[model samples]
Target: MTTVPRRFEILLVAGFTESDETPPTSAHALRSAVVEATGETGESGYPRYAGNGMEADIDPATRTVEALLVDGAEIDYGLSVRVVAAPAT
Candidate 1:
């Protein structure tokens, strides 16, 4: 089976809040859950969203992080982002 890269276009990100008391098992799980929670749909046969490398710092204080960068289109869809967080600089 071909391995899907850790990077893909994030089509949508829905705002949500989960009980932080319930800890995530692994970093992979956390990332996957977050991506799924975003409500992203990588649908084919439609205008597919593309990923842009723009990113923001995670702030535990703010409890909110900037959404991923997606190719801006006039259509009604939201932004897309990389599936995995970019490597630390």
Candidate 2:
């Protein structure tokens, strides 16, 4: 990989936590290409820091993205928000 700083691919992760307490087991993993591209178009490019968390329960089998999780809480379809890379630190 190139050692270019601030130049890396972000990832979008989600989880299903209705019963478990320790951590989530089932999850959705997706490349953050869409978020990166949109950020570029919006003039706010990659390496963004959302401060809070952004995630969604994306089901490939059902072709659905729902149950957004932000700041450790379940919310509605919140994909129309800024999605950044990493743990925001």
Candidate 3:
């Protein structure tokens, strides 16, 4: 039998409110999620979206990054990224 410690998965989501702009992506688009280390509260770089006064946020509990634009606004496009942990050998 093999023992494995419990880990978390991170995901990112974006919502557009009738806006014609490309969604923002992680600075490290290559690698999205990271394993939570011992007391590791690392912060990732969130680049500006054409300086449109927009910013990205993350929810550690839900492990999700959501845009704060949910006020009866029409979300045209959306993106959901699933981050999976590597299998143990």
Candidate 4:
């Protein structure tokens, strides 16, 4: 089994809330939300944020976001994120 992390593109969906309908506008915000929802941390004990989009490291064997067992929902912003696709190996 490989221990290296693979790159995967993530999808972020805006969920409906009683008071909020605005979706996340920046990658930073999405990254923060993902970290809050998944509670995932890197070797330095901090959430890793990729470039400008919603991209993250996913275990290729599992092909799932770590700590995000459910449909990846963040209650604060009512944002839902998921692993959409991985780059061609």
Model 2, span 11-58: residue lDDT tens = 444433447454211133432422111121112222232222543433
* lDDT tens digits by residue: candidate 1, 31-70: 2222222223323211122334323222222323343332
Report the CA-based lDDT of candidate 3 relative to the real structure: 0.34
- Best model per TM-score: 4
- Best of the two (1, 4) by lDDT: 4
Candidate 4 lDDT at 30 equals: 42
**Pairs in clash, predicted candidate 2:** none
Indicate whether candidate 3 or candidate 4 has the larger TM-score: 4
lDDT of 4 by residue, 1-89 (tens): 55434344555555534475543343533443222223355444434435332334444455444433223332345665555344454
Better of 1 and 3 by lDDT: 3
Looking at model 4, the pairs that clash are: none
Q: Which sequence of candidate numbers ranks them by lDDT, best first?
A: 4, 3, 2, 1
Cα deviation at 28, candidate 1, in Å, is 4.8
Pitting candidate 2 against candidate 4, the one with the higher lDDT is 4
RMSD of candidate 1 to the truth, in angstroms, is: 13.4
Runs in model 1 deviating more than 4 A are 1-21, 27-54, 69-89
Between candidates 3 and 4, name the one with more favorable lDDT: 4
Best by lDDT: 4
Clashes of each: 2, 0, 0, 0
| TM-scores of all candidate predictions against the true structure | 0.22, 0.23, 0.22, 0.35
